[model samples]
Target chain A: MAQIIQIDRPVETSKSKNVIRKTMSICPECMKILPADVFERDGKVFMSKVCPTHGEVEELYFGSYEMYTKFSTYWTDGKGALSPNVPIDKCACPTNCGLCSNHLSHTGLGNMIITNRCDLTCWYCFFYVKKGLEGAYVYEPTMEQMTAMIRTLRAQRPVPGNSMQITGGEPTLREDLVDIVKMIKREGINHVQLNTNGINIALNTDLALKLREAGVSNLYLSFDGVTPKTNPKNHWEAPYTIENCRKAHLGVVLVPTVIKSINDHELGDILRFAQTNIDTVRAISYQPVSLTGRMSKKEREKYRITIPDCIERIEEQTNGEVTKDDWFPVPTCSPVTHFIEAFTKKPQYELSIHFACGAGTYVFEDADTKKLVPITKFVDIRGLLEFLEEKTEELESGANRYVIAARFLSKINGFVNKEKQPKGLSLAKLLTSALLKHDYSSVGQFHLNSMFLGMMHFQDKYNQDEERLQRCDIHYVTPDMRIIPFCSFNVIPEWYRDRIQQKYGMPIEEWEKKTGEKLEQRLYRGTLRRNIAKHEMNQMACATQAAHIEPITGT
Target chain B: MKYVYEPVKGLERTCIRNISISSSSDTVRLDEPVDFTVKLSVAGGIRDAFTSDLWEKAWDAWDKTFRMTYNIGIKKVVAGPITKDVIKSQKFVRRATFYWSRSPELNPDYSKKIWVMVVLEGREPVHPKSVDEAKTTLFDVKKTFRVMGSDLGKGKHALKAFGKASWGRHIFGEKGNSQSVSKEITITCK
Candidate 1:
């Protein structure tokens, strides 16, 4: 007989305390729309919803109510997509969402899933071969279908999305991956990024060079933590992958899927690793694991971590190097977009996402102390934003162009504190050049001096908010040429990703017979023995030197 | 009698003298009125680039160009919430304000008509009433505007007020002038 475990429990409930706001969420069991109340308890914000069939479900929404409210102040509604695929009068949100008119933002980063066939079956991954095994189909879109999808994305009006991310079960597994990149570039997408595990890049020496030559601007490398135990997926292979990326001059952004009690403890070490490898690693993006599949409330509570939670962890782990106050919501850059639109009299790329969806801040390395300096340490970011807003409003009100420009040049010095500025960085001059002269070269200089730190928390059915769904700017383009938001596609895979991919996929039996390999046999085991051996040799050399070794002559 | 003319090297060129802003109080009650003064000074001999007749012609051309291109009209007003009849009636006065009040070349008469638009918590632009002015070597204009209690709600608010000098057409490489000074004020609702 199984052993039974019992623990102390308190059942008294008068009235749930600290209700902050009311929103809408979905039932995890029945997937029904339900009224949800957001409240604070134990310093964490949580969403509680009661479904008629599912009973009561609660999930942590934000780690800190104070931080949530502080970031909420930056909220601004976006000028939704032009030429929405669905009419607002016909249907409600989420149900009619191939980017219905109810959506508040256009697609900023469009994702194209080329193949739903990966080489690794990670325990936490949303996409793997198991889905195909269960459904009896292999989801791999044809090149023609991919081209059509890219066309559909570029055809989006008001502002045709200029950036696209090629994603997959593993995009690098495709033999024609370079050709796909070429095709995307041919379609006139300026920024083409690939989301991949670094195993392929590390194993194939010429592959990184080929991708770079094919115009793959950036690689969204999946790197969880520094230690091998914490990141068994790619810890042993990351160094070689990063070195190959450096050799190819391809920029990489470290993407860590942080789960509490698993890899969350290693965030500070991961950040330190990123700083040391800043040349190849452009940014470190933390994604708190979302409970997409079947999960109990207790399991959800144990695993779920929000953006603020990640930020707080980063602060604690980095020993206050990156504090909560240093970060701002992703949508804080909306003013820059607004100003550009007003000045140029054209539609610009707008990031009008919900403030709670993501937060980011840039950290520059101080020349004197060699320590990372948060942008707010030197530049008066809030003051600069206010100034930009004022200037944009003035421009909209028909302010004289020459006079505004001259005044901006003269008063730019007042907004920046020279004494607090980073060593060898003339922030005032950089701001003046970027804002007044519209010279973006200074922005490149700024990036060269700093690294971007950001975190994005995707939602599952347990905590999905309709408001967030309406404001999502990241979308996935399907083989059928429909644009669905990321959370909607992943969270409710049955309705969007699975349904669409099944229509275009082949039967699993046929795929196995034709490919002459079973699904389980196709998983990627690393083949970069030379690079791994070199890395091991370097580590051994360092260890020997640390022990003060001396070479012996012929004895 | 005229002596041999000699050109001086490194002679100082005409430029803007100074721009300054001051508020009546650092803190104000919500839904109450506050006043601000903006002063602009132009260096001497800056207008030497043009004769009086040429300057007048340039000003006229600038005004005509501005009116033709950007003058807010019935169609544009209709695009906003205000109705054409309401605008046509004496019920509303819709005038374009300057970008920056401290531009050296801004017309003094135009600057007098300019007002400071106070934006609080992303609300509608509040046009302040011009109370006083002293135009000399240094041009000064004082204006007042009210902040709504609802805008502040509670606690502290960042009150951003800027003098907008709208000259219609492009001037000084931009459309208008806006003072760069922003003030933060704590508002206590009564």
Candidate 2:
């Protein structure tokens, strides 16, 4: 028999209401339960306890108190749903758009949309750029906006000063590109640059001259193949021919999006074009499409190619003079492929190449010099967007004239001597000398680990072939700009990128304050000591083992 | 070997002091210290040649001691100039054999034999505060015996003889354990 007690109920009269809110704290490391009211300050949660081994576990915070328990369990098992209660309100499109802070941290490269319109729509475009996908007016910018963006860029300086690359369906399609360049120069962002298809420069020599006059230093030109026949359409979307590129008088790096069936056999022709356009054309970068975008999985598979195969083809065509082993991985994009110059016969030395999947970073060894070098640069597609938004004020200036002039002259020079141009030092060779000189033994190996960590960010599996990507520290970079305690091998889904950008939407100012490490300084300051310490600790831990001894007398 | 003794009530103090040895004491031999003395003597002239090994034994023992203290290992000690300082008198003396008196006797078959009696004596007493300059002295009785009608040089052989003696803790002078019984006798042809 159960005893039920019923107290006197209020006679349906409502006067006041009393509400009780319960809170609890959690341990991030072990997920042990703790009461909430222990320590609370500035809307942050904390708890302290002495573990059995006398390990003093310190404070921890729960961004959303209601979902703390759920998060604890989720992190432990890598399962469970996100904290829906603590909804992200900053960014407009959270889950839908992939520019969240978390995603940005994982994707070290910044995004720069040169224009809304594109001349050719590749089926495997990663940006979801389709026929009707264009946003806003193509090439729409006021001098004020450009200037303002430039100013913001200067103010929100990132660590390890990165390059700002303007890219679109074709940045040249935008008439104001020259003006934009001028504004970038006027704002004194000497590193301002663009990624483009050289078509406009080839058709309009005057436009090229103007762009060169604006003082644009380098050009990441989309020159996918040597011949139009390499494409299925037998088509070349870029308006400029190899001749026009020479005339541009700019340091043009030939960016080729290698398609497996179409241009896989044209390695020789591509290298030949590069050599012919020597001084004006710096390096030929072969990029195999990641097959992300509006294309179907089947279609992507049909067209997707790899960088290794290209390296092999180059070796075979050049009779081993240019081989795959000679190529060195780019610090930022090591997993995708390597970069090689015309001169290196399996070069064994270099400056330094780094991979930055946010702060999860690594550098690489030089194939020519076999030296360990620091990672000097990285790519941040989202940061580029932030740059465009911030530096809108300096979009127009007289300095733009020099950029256009340089391009025009370089292109004209090439056009005149298209057949028998004298070969010169390649940009890859120069950059190798400048950025990658191995300063210490075993540094190359550490850099390789850092690179591997970064590659792990993009894909779940380790790409051993990517020398740098296989060796980088993967978990160092965090969404709030704080580096992880060490590189943790926790898997981060690509979808998280969209969520982070949408939720935190951390501005550059906030990033600097939170990280306590100036972003721009990372470019010059090497983190070799930290890297070496980590390696030493890893080695010691690996070698330590238990031992037993017994007395010979058996006493 | 054990000896049996029975006593009556009045003879209680007269008990047997049995002395059992694994072998005869006089039969024992020492390999070193050839110039040494023993309580036993040769039974005949021919016997003296067989057991007269004292000079060799003494020389060997002296050499061993000298080697242990010097002339070996990393640090070698070479004998310096033979100065009088090295002839210091021994603070105490020990002997393996007791002092003995010997008398020669003629025998048949052209052989000779000797009768000997062992004796021991204490050294002369001296004042406590005498200026004792350390010096050694040897008995000069060499002229008492002759072999093949030729005189042996002054007691050199006797002086060279050293007894197979054991080191002692006390009685640091010439007055201890000087008398004992002789096991045999010796004779030299003249």
Candidate 3:
């Protein structure tokens, strides 16, 4: 028998001038879809929903109403997946989501969990040893299951997901991690990112090199803050981990799970640190922590930090180097896909996601002053982009390629002003060549001078919007050959993550008895003595180089 | 038609008059048609002083064909690569040239000299030395150009256009005079 749930909401009052928009939300307790009102009060946007059994619930939907409106313009509908795992008539919207035909976006970044077993027990983590112990299941997928998951992701239509992230309680716990990476690469996945706490990489340098050699593109390292107090999980070992990544030539993107009044204050410090070690640190993705576990309304308010709050804090802390105005929602690039499709007359890859899901921008280091420069400083990006959109229309209207190319050349100068561009940057030439000639060598040159700065705020049950779920492009592929959106999988674990894992997982005692080895939680306390000694020796070498090198007086 | 010298008060000064510009729409999609119409009146005809005397004696030197240079400026209201310093210090504009011929018989060589001039905004315009160089300066000859949309960013944008004319010397009319009136429109991209 199908379980039924009832949804209810309070009547709107005449004084509700704060309501910005209306959407659908799910009950945190009953998971019943309900009509929700999005309102603005105290400069923050909140979504209020009512479930008959669960009562009323209100959660912070957005930190700023202005930012929300600004981001809302970039919304676009996505082309549904080609090979949907679930039939449209099978069940409800989210419940039947094996990426059903109703989903709005293609999988941009697919996540595959290798194991549910984690080394440490972080109080804030969604998945921990306690849940596994209580659930009486070891939710680690076998090698076959992992491969099937990857295959399912690749089978997505229009364009296969070229990028994938291997995540877990700790993916590094798997002994065959290098082999797994190799298999993923062999399967033609262009980029394979590993999400880790950075303990194993710091302890074993060889392991880092092995993973890199096996085709691991980069490391999404957990780095909440610079100090041990805010980031107690792997504070002592982070530096060593970063040093190893640098040596192994594996780029690291610091993933900070920001909680309000906790590690939020250290955002600017983290950005500065990333800049200081710009050689190996490619980017910093500040994930405002999602509340999925049990918590009170007061607790939620105390800890919830939205994307706008993070942007504001960064601007304040960075002294306006990275301002609130510099950030843009992730789906702003939808027009690019639109233009490409019209120009090429073929189906193309698109980022047709909800406007409020994420925001990002690029910052380049000015060679002359060594100061951070936002990309907008030198290019008339808006004009060039508008011109491109116009040109794409001309192409679709039967305008010849020569005519289109000619138009591009003519308007290129208007979009990129050479004189006001960076001292060494030739934006006009780069843009012309890139747009007309299709030469991307200049794009590589641009990356050499710039770094990506972005943030993604994943939805939890309290603030989950049905619209966001329908447009979500980031997904996790379960062993059941199902591709579920990240929010649907983790936000309501019982419906997806836990349900699938429980069916495949074994009890910890049973596993221990079968393997004849007792399982224990091993917390990484820092680097080993040898690794620390090696680090000191390298530091001494650099110091010696600076000290021994003198003026040519002796010569 | 041959060049006819119109004796007027601003005849010697050479002035451009009644400049007007308009776009097909105030807002358009990224890959949609956007037509622009530029209408202007030219008076006080003059010729380039650098022409050889022999050619000047044989042809009507005073026959003026307005050489209008279109300047397009774009300001992003959303986050983009353009910085505040770039916006403040530089005129975020690009240039393309168009010529409205008054009398073809008066200057038979006008077709050869009607090539478009592409100028990088905020920089001194460098004269093209060859046809290839001139071709490189131009993407299209028409006033309308299409917008190339991408996934970089999107928001409200102010697209503006102004023009300058060339007679004997580059002529930019006074505030309310013959200068080409600048046109502006707000475009939104999604």
Candidate 4:
């Protein structure tokens, strides 16, 4: 059975004003009960909870179904995954829709919408950019308006902080793109990143220089796999190859969207590629697919892969260097616990490269001599605490400052008290110089269809900053231009639809309005969700089978 | 005020401005001549920390003859940079004194001072680059009439002595010579 993690908190009425009393989280990974507290800082809401085996549960605000589907398709295509697997949903609130109180409490908003225009047509495009859906999506933002929006945001909040990222179907398509970058620089934004397929960057040196001058901090590059046989053209919707990203001077993040059957065998190759590109590619983010695109239920099932299996594949490929035994259960509040651990066998610099086996990143250390030691076992909460305390002592004496122990302690403590989190700090700080922030590069979720379709659901929520959400600002250079937030095919309110129709001077009422129909008919019929439900039921039925996990107790 | 510089060789009373009254008929309206005196100052930019030693050296320098011959009417002239103008001798006998102002409230970090020079037309030596008569008349006179220690105006130093004078250099590093030129001035006492 899948692990059940639970989180429960007691209420306190002592304070004069309002206070978040308790929060609960159920990890779908390792089943461990965890109590958590919600934190709010600079308008962003965060949760700090740990599953005994999963490590640290540090999560950002929201994720989309569309994104997961594209990732699934890309990973599956590259990995040649053909198994009946389902990647677990990470952001499942018992209550769905926009009314999630947990989501509502978060105020910090950081997002990167690479592009709606892509070079290839994938089977599972989030925005559904395949042949039949040519007119369905329009994701290009005018350079002037985009620059203005960035300026307005930066004027409101400057960095040492987070800023929205530039993405596109591929953002490099616009000719005068460097002007937009210059505008962002004028706004004094601290961090501006690009999410791209890296095709343009690899080919154009001048573009890279202009981007640097315009203050682009990082690049999120889509890298599916190492070999062409493993990542054939039919498997990947886009023409993303490794050679294209090498030309970029900025850091690159390799995102592999894991599909069960396709690229599953290439797990070792993926890790090796990331390790080799440590100088340019700072990190590798493995995003197992979530279902939300043009893929039917049967298709999703064919590519259903979980984060656990992905880690196990890495272990198998690495010859037990990184294994389930090495990974500890990340802390949780529900019956489920997520386990995220890394091998201590690699050198400090190599280990520093960012990889998300999912439970965010957790750092572990030694107990007695106060020397830095590699974490080789899954320690209980008590053992973890003792080890951390000793590590903290070592830090106070200025011994292990070079290692990640002190920062880890602060992160854990700050996560525990979310509201009072530190200023100008990010979950990314725990990462080393070798890792660049991953753009939406994971093939599993960032497939053309997944990106297009997944982003449709987020149209209303994308431009909003952490503190407030409202109708975003847009400028119409054309007198009769229509502003489509998530492209023309997305489910928009009637008024928005009518306005666009009027601008185009098309038959106001005669133009076909087919909203959510393509999605329902093509992808949702036998969706990934149904497939996972079937798999879970099968597992439940085989209760006494060899797959059962024997719960182990600490000494 | 009388203009005099003490730090040069034997020569005194370099430049002076005097106002005189001449009457002819009784009950006749007469215009009185108004005289003006400006004191120039010269000293090392370096400050002398020891009060007694500084005073001894300063007095010795002042006793020396520092004078320039500038053809002008002189009557009851007081040569020195004005520090305090007091009502004396039934006239505004301005006391030649120098003072410094260092208010921490105004400038907390560092204090600064400005050097003021009084130029006498025609009576001063002409600069070599003084192209015109007007320019030469203005350029010739150079002396230190008074040295205002801490933020004082007018009565600071005696600028009548040419020996105590320093030539003004061009910004691009060119130097000018001090010599007499065909320059003359008419002082109409009105």
lDDT of 3 by residue, A302-386 (tens): 9999999999999988888888878878876765665566666666666766777888888866666656777666666556655
TM-score of chain B taken alone, every candidate: 0.32, 0.15, 0.36, 0.19
User: Which TM-score value belongs to model 1?
Assistant: 0.71
lDDT of 4 by residue, A83-105 (tens): 10112223222212121221211
Per-residue lDDT tens digits for candidate 2, residues B1-190, read: 1122211122112111111111112221232111112221112221122111321232222110000000000111123311122111122221121100011111112111211111111212111111111001111001111122122212221111111111211111111111112122221212
Off by over 4 Å in 2: A1-111, A126-143, A157-162, A232-241, A293-301, A332-555, B1-190
Q: Per-residue error at A44 for model 4, in Å?
A: 32
Q: Taking the candidates in order, what DockQ does each have?
A: 0.02, 0.00, 0.01, 0.00
The TM-score values for the models, in the order shown, are 0.71, 0.35, 0.70, 0.36
The positional error of residue A286 in candidate 1, measured at the CA in angstroms, is 0.4
Q: On residues A444-465, what C-alpha lDDT tens digit does candidate 1 reach at each position?
A: 7776667899888888898888
In terms of lDDT, the poorest run of 10 residues in model 2 chain A is: A546-555
- lDDT values for all models: 0.65, 0.30, 0.65, 0.32
Residue range A276-385, candidate 2, lDDT tens digits? 34435545566644333234436544664444445566558646545443433333122111112111112121112222112122223233442322233322322222
Clashes, model 1 = 24
